[model samples]
Target: MRIAILAHEQFPDGAKTALGVLRYADDEVVAVLDRDRSGHRVTDFVSDVQDAPIVAGMGDLEDDVDALLIGIAPIGGGFEESWREDVRTALERGCDVVSGLHYFLSEDEEFVELAAENGCELRDVRRPPDDLSVSEGVAADVDAEVILTVGTDCSVGKMTATMKLARDARAAGYDAEVIPTGQTGIMIEGWGIPVDRVVSDFTAGAVEEMILECGDDHDYLFVEGQGSIVHPAYSGVTCGILHGAMPDRLVLCHDAGRQAIGGYESFSLPSIPTYVDLYERLAEPVRDAPVVAGALNTAGLAEPAAREAVDEFAASLDAPATDVIRFGTDEVLETLLSSNPNR
Candidate 1:
């Protein structure tokens, strides 16, 4: 089968590589589209697909291919329209379409109806991998009453939230350990949680091992996945880690500030977005999965703002107090977790 992947040039290397895996398994690739010209070339990875051919425009692929993998590279306003037209054209050509990039705007009723009428299968490729068939609880959840996963990167709140939950568990008189996913030090003692250094390697097996080690003997484990794997500068291998560990509950750390209000701007939230507005956005791909609310490092050294935000966000979502905590100071962490029984 001849498959064509239409993408923007700025697409993240990890996703491109993952798509390449699909390409490697499938037949020839007809085209690879992108708006930008320079970066780590996709051809290196998709050698066989490249051997077939690549065209600069999605329109160029028309009627020449059987399947069209629409790689939705995050594009802004005008480009988004152009890309949608390209997608529609591919569908009209009777091609099967799959996409992980965010392109479905609520207002795109015309495009949506057209796509439905055309019988194109638009699938989100970046959605969680569902075929693992791995057993949950096989590697015991950490036996410590609670475990905290921390980091020094953009989404430290994810780590802090996990730690606070652990501290809260201990303040309520349960044993807990707050370990840094990186080298960040534990600010306070007591609370009964120990901080450990995260492993440097971020491959699938390595991440799985880290989770197994951290969660060993602990009842509740807080694994932090900070930053978007799709972003270039903020490269932390978060997606691979998430895929490898598959934490009991994923607390996706997001920015809750002005930018992320409605999430109409971007399909996948930015790595360090201000806040999470669309709950359905986070829930859908993970199979309508449960997610703990996580925020970025906004309330550092401040008493009320971070705590208030987390509380309000949780209240709105009715998220479990036990599962959600402010990614802030030790005092705040203690206060948040102390109220929950599931620590």
Candidate 2:
């Protein structure tokens, strides 16, 4: 399908969902709706992904789009009021409106009416399943080797690392699958329970259900991680995923040179060694998961600095490390394969 991403002011960095769709999705991205960077091309900011025009709004779109994807996943997953008009315009143009936010566009009366009138579809990707229950602690019993991506903080490349590793593993002739836990992953994979959207009591259960479904079929399950364990606001979801996954190996993800939580700047992040210790200790009771590797986000850093950061991060974690996007996933994937006894 051809599409346009509505990211408003949060393009590139803040619109992670947009980047993920641009880099990995099968659909063609015709344009990006970001008022702040109106006339700039996506190639100007990010060279690796699909190139598309950056329009100011839906009306500015020069090409016909099959869908309008809400690409910014904010802290609360709230919908922006300023975006309502653009969404309305898309619906009026008979285009599907896809959103990953906690706020459901399908439930909104105005959007709902507009969709019906234009015969358009409104997809809320973050909607949780109705049968979700508490975790049964059976995630560890699966036959597959589970390697989950845990993060030092939010948006540190957990989803990116998980997807990259899964892709490379499959390309290497291994039966691997990515068990997505977020909206962006769900959008890319076409199926997954958004763990963060699930009720707090059922978050672990939600993750467990997916693992149980895919575990026996694939040799490896690359479970995408969520919020940082140290994040005050999002730690619950992070812990739920960790305990629910009960993974055999963990890949700690972090943004290079990030000293504090992304949004909460007052609370500084713990040292890399401290984070490793915390994750291992926390996973001990559920399952003895060790930090097998590291995925560092080195965006905006020069080549030399990025390499230096990767070396330092690897030294601190005492494991293989690399920027999966800039470099390949070879180092981390090799480490995972070597560490897995079944392989």
Candidate 2: deviation at residue 283, Å?
0.9
Q: Least lDDT summed over 10 consecutive residues: which range in candidate 2? A: 334-343
What TM-score against the true fold does each predicted structure earn? 0.37, 0.95
- Residue-level lDDT for 258 in candidate 2: 94
* Cα deviation of 332, candidate 2, in Å: 0.9
Alpha-carbon lDDT of model 2 = 0.92
Residue 102, candidate 1: how far off, in angstroms? 34
Which residue pairs of candidate 2 clash?
A: none
Q: Residue 245 in candidate 1 has what lDDT?
A: 47
Best by the lDDT measure: 2
* Local lDDT at 324 for model 2: 95
Deviation (Å) of 270 in candidate 1: 5.5
Tens-digit per-residue lDDT, 272-340, candidate 2: 999999999999999899999999999969999999999999999999999999988887899897756
